[model samples]
Target: MNIFVAGMMMETNSFSAIPCTRDSFVNAMYYRPEHTGPDPEPAAYEQFGYRTFLRLARERGYGAYASLHAFAEPAAPCRQEDYESLRDEILDDLRAAMPVDMVFLMLHGAQMAQGYDDCEGDIIEKVREITGPDIFIGVELDLHGNVTTRMAEASNALVACLLYPHTDFDERGEQLFAIGERFARGEIRTRNHLQRVPMLGLYYTTLPHMMAVNDAVLAAERQDGIHSVSLMHGFAWADHPDVGAAVIVVAESGQGGVPDLARDIGRQFFAARDETRSLRRPVDDILGAIAASPEAGPFVIADVADNAGGGAGADSTFILTRLIERGIKDAALAMIWDPIAVDFAWQAGIGNRLNLRLGGKTGPFAGLPVDGEATVVALADAIEQEDPAGGLMFGIGRAALLRIGGILVAVNSIRQQVYDPVCLTGLGVDLSALRIVVVKSTQHFYERFSTLATGIFYCETPGSLTLDFDAGRYSRLRRPIWPIDADAAPA
Candidate 1:
């Protein structure tokens, strides 16, 4: 069967000041063959979902045609022109390649365009109009996907990664394709049932270390006729009307079975909602733990509030500022995404001592740029490396190592989430000798660093996607949710 695969993904943070444009996508990650070369395909960390989907579909003996796949680091809502042009380009390609048996999409479910709040839903609806209702459509989404009713009604079948800090992209892609293959053979008539929890939150609830949501996911996986079960923690940054956590169950038939399974899972999710809300430690508590630890091994401190994966500007220097204040030496922060700083460092060359202002360039929430004298340690144009902690592959764009005061910072031109040590060691930064390693990511960093770290702490700070949702100046989110009201009854 002929299958068409294409994707456009970008998580929107409504609160962010950064406007996502075509140039932003290009600067962050532009993989056009004409621009790069014939052999070296445009590759970036954000395209992980799309690449895996195409790879799995080709392996399943289907004639897979990947038209185009484009993604950028999480940022503010996309511009109207940029969104329409990209959407039309993908749809235009799909129309030309019509008569395909199936279409698989990789989407960041929380995307908000200038004129469109439900862009993914709109794309799916438009694609449905082109392919018609009978044509099978499948989607692979991040666990942070906002599984809106509009999205649920438009797509034929959908699957989301179960793990937070998501290491299950490939696994979920395989599952989605398997379901598509089953549909092609007429083996299973798939139906999906989705239920949204009242509260809106981040990745704290989805952690395996946290029992409530984790056990519920495990239980749903055991249910019969349930091909796949996903718990979308939902993207908390997008201030759309459909912002909240959700449970989706894909069953064998498009009937009562899926709904029943979904309800079972939804109830459990609601029952445990309290336990899942806002799990984090204060900055002081995290620092105390680090000071108490005796192991010489590097400890990982997660700056969740400034996680780029959650649409926060990776340039936030709150954690870095505090590190410098504490006089913490022998530590590394793999990365602070600033093209200007990287360019300045590049011009300075390796071993050159220079004064530079790093990070805090995004906005006030990101704090002010730290001005200090730093020594250039190492420099590299491209680093093809795997996450030392999780084994996930990532491409680090033009990067440089600079030692500022007591801390070592790896500055990259590209904005990305640093999940593993390879992002550092790949560029000649030693991971074994450092006392602490600060990662500007949420839970995805856990998969790789949890075992290696003597201590892992999530630092509460200030940024667009801060874990302190209650403290955020939100204008749109539906209220009475947990933590927002301690006395309010659970969903």
Candidate 2:
């Protein structure tokens, strides 16, 4: 059977000031038909999904045709013209390759474009129109996805990663393929039930600890006729009409019992929603914790607010500024995405000290400009390493390393979630040797560093995707959601 596989994946933070252009998407790793080649080491999170699809398709003996996979660094609402141009191109290709039995989409469900509140829904609806409702369509989403009503109505089956650190991309792909095969054989007709929970919170600390959500996921997985279940914590930074936690259940009975299961699970999620509201710590508290910790191992403090994975500018200087202020020596930051600064550093050879104004270039959310003279300790054409969080198969792109003050920052030309030690170790900054290691990421980094770290702290700072949901000026999000209103009831 021929399977058409393609979709755009990027978590657009409506609050971010940066505009996601075609070039931004390309720089983050856009692979077209002919461009698919050897996978890069220290893989970007989304690339893991694309590669998993390719491997499974080949293994299942299905003819796979992929249009293009374009992901941008998380940012503000997508431009209508850019979204249309990209969506139309992919749709045009899918239409030309019609008569395919199934379509597998890889999408970041929280995307908000200028004219579209539900970009995934828009794409699926357009695909449904072309495929005439008979074709089996399957979708795989990030755990942080905002599963909307439109999304539930447009696809045949959908599954999201269960893990917060999202170490389940390949497993989710395998499950999607298994479900697609069942759909193709008419063995199981699945329907989805989606219910929104009244909470806007971060899922960084929820996993490996929260029993309610994990038990729900486990119970749903064990139930008969329940093909798959997902709890999308929803990217809280994304300011859209539908921005809150959601529970999605895919059941085998086409008889429409999915919503019952969905509500049951969603209610359980809602009961525990209040507990998941706040971040692990504010910036000051994080500094205090670091100062109090006596362990020699690197204290990994994640600057969750400015995470690039959640559409925040990775250039935020809040954590870096605090580290510099407290005279925290032997500290390292995996990355700060300032291409211009990186370019300037590249021009200045190793061992040369140069005055640089780094980070805070994106917007006020990224914090103020950090001005300091940094010595170029080491320069490399490219550094390759395996992903720390990715089990056995993921990879990241070429990276460069530079030293600014006591902080050794590994800047990549590519935008990626810093999930592995290689993101720093490849750049000559040994994570084991440092007292503190600050990374610009959300939960994805936890899987890799949990074992090595003496302690892990998620710091609340300012950026597009901040934990301070109440502080954000949201124009379209439906009101009466959690923390936003303590007494708000679930829909």
Candidate No. with top TM-score: 2
lDDT against the true structure, per candidate, is 0.74, 0.75
lDDT of 1 by residue, 333-439 (tens): 98798888888889999999989999998888899899989888888887755543224356778898899888889888877777777778877877888889988
Which sections of candidate 2 miss by over 4 Å? 34-48, 51-54, 205-211, 253-257, 274-279, 384-405, 411-415
> Which segments of candidate 1 are over 4 A away from where they belong?
27-48, 51-61, 204-215, 218-224, 252-254, 257-260, 271-279, 385-394, 470-472, 487-491
By summed lDDT, which 10 consecutive residues of candidate 1 come out lowest? 33-42
Give the total clashing residue pairs for model 1: 4
What's the TM-score of every candidate structure? 0.88, 0.89
Q: After superposition, how far is residue 144 of candidate 2 from its true place, in Å?
A: 1.6
